[model samples]
Target: MSESLQTLQTGPSAAAPGDFGWHLGMVLRGYQFLFEEAVEGMPAGIRGYQILSTVLHRDPPNQQALGAHLAIDRTVLTYLLDALVDAGVVERVPAPSDRRARKIVATDNGREILAQYEERVATAESELLSGLKEPEADTLATLIARLAMDVHRSQPGSSPCEAMDHLP
Candidate 1:
């Protein structure tokens, strides 16, 4: 077995000084709980925010590309898009180049809502990382971003969160 796998298999008492999996898992769990709460009022919670944010950031090529960028299933993306439309956060405009297809776009209200959600999410993130000093937290965030970029580059179509889909 690989050294890392072995380290995780042994309980803390018998394991190496720190187990990466355990630490990462604990952090993810904490963030998930906090994030769920932070975006609870959103259309589909975190997912709705993701779609809205993506639209605000770019001119989507089409619904399929949007779903691919997010690593969301096409069918699921449709449902999320419907909710976002109902919430007045996003709209499907006819694709300029392909009249047959629709492109997702954010509304002015969507941008405003995203800004509010950003504040809440940032606060939740700060609370989750409160154990770390500011500098330490910044360092951790930088390192994680680098790692995510590497994963994204390694798997051309995989988003950082869904990079695991490309793993063996």
Candidate 2:
């Protein structure tokens, strides 16, 4: 067939080790496993970490905006928030601009938890990039972040998250 098809059929070459997807998949899997272990006792695991970080760092979106941004369903986000609230990690506060709207905010305990785990998460991430040297890791991080932003900009609002249903 075509040259490109032939290349694809050959799989990873001896020198290349892996294609982009292979590398990305490996990193994703590694982080998921490591992060799970790191945040073992946290509610919702990785999702909980994401929620805590977002609420702590971002402008603190309301439930609807939070769900949309995170690609979590309204119902599911509601349940997650309930758990987070019960855990004393987050609280539902009235939006400043609109009292009718409720926004998610991290409690002092939540901020402390985020601070406590930040170093742990960083260490796990560093372990994932153990193959790279210090400079290489920094360069790779910069390049990957730039690439991610480019990809995001290229796709206005075509996130696969929109089409996919929340997994059980």
Candidate 3:
């Protein structure tokens, strides 16, 4: 097995010294739970919701452009779009500029679902950040956004750091 895989298998049950991987794993687990429990029924995960929301406000976003702006892989984005299409929350239309390219647009149902889920996500996040006051929460958000923009500007070929970035 790969060294990384082996380390993952034998690492401390909880995060330990020099265990950034373990901490990231825990964060992913928590995110999955929070998303599934709080936002699953809302038409998409946070990523999907963001895509739909963006498309609603800015329709006819070609897949490549969407992938670039959202920093999602085209392959993974294909599946996410498929799910949304299957759910009747979004539609893919052939791009007017390029027949080979397809654009994503939010359906009416998608808009409603996204709206509902956004509220739920806000509630869940507020609960998670309850320890901080409103001003602190706002400051944290601003700082995180700045950090994400910096990382994105610096990383040319890297997929977005999911934790540091948001759907927008």
Candidate 4:
């Protein structure tokens, strides 16, 4: 077998299929697949979708503050924002308090696109979590949210996931 396959086979197995790590990897891959397939027509990838959604919810957030919140580095965030700006999905405005700071805001077109993507994403998520009942899914979400909040609180500079760096 290939080295990668052998490594996976020998790794830890906290869940049924493989170790917790393996399961996490599979889950992330699944999410990526769904996001790519579902948002094919959208101008942004999953990360862009997330950033657009976040900006819509929290309008006019400075680039640095937004990057910190989303755990995205300045370089990647710049590229993502540039793409969104090019697509007319988001706009960068001057900060009210700081002339040097640039704030991100979603445009009307961006909001409409996000709304469509939201429905698609929700459907995809429901399908992905079909193994769980509604209540179980809700409980799982709550638990995950709590854990995430705790981790964020404990780690001052750490973001949720490194992959999320593409989003903010």
Ten-residue stretch with the least lDDT total in model 1: 159-168
| Candidate 3: residue 65 Cα off by (Å) | 1.1
lDDT tens string, model 3, 1-168?
887766766745844455765655665566566656677765547678768867877663598888887778888889889989999998988888898989887788888888888787778777766878999989978987897688778985566436445422
The lowest-lDDT stretch of 10 consecutive residues in candidate 3 is 159-168
lDDT of 1 by residue, 73-115 (tens): 8988999999999999899999988999999988898889999
Worst 10 residues of 2 by lDDT: 159-168
Per-residue lDDT tens digits for candidate 4, residues 35-87, read 77778777658669878878888763588988888787799899989999999
Candidate 1: residue 141 lDDT (0-100) = 99
lDDT scores for all predictions?
A: 0.84, 0.77, 0.75, 0.80
Clashing residue pairs for model 3 = none
- Pitting candidate 1 against candidate 4, the one with the higher lDDT is 1
lDDT for model 2, please.
Answer: 0.77
In order of lDDT, best first, we have: 1, 4, 2, 3
* Residue 45, candidate 3: alpha-carbon lDDT: 75
Top candidate when judged by lDDT against the true structure: 1
Residue 33 lDDT in candidate 1: 87
> Clash pairs of candidate 1?
none
User: Model 4, residue 166: displacement in angstroms?
Assistant: 14
Winner of 3 and 4 under TM-score: 4
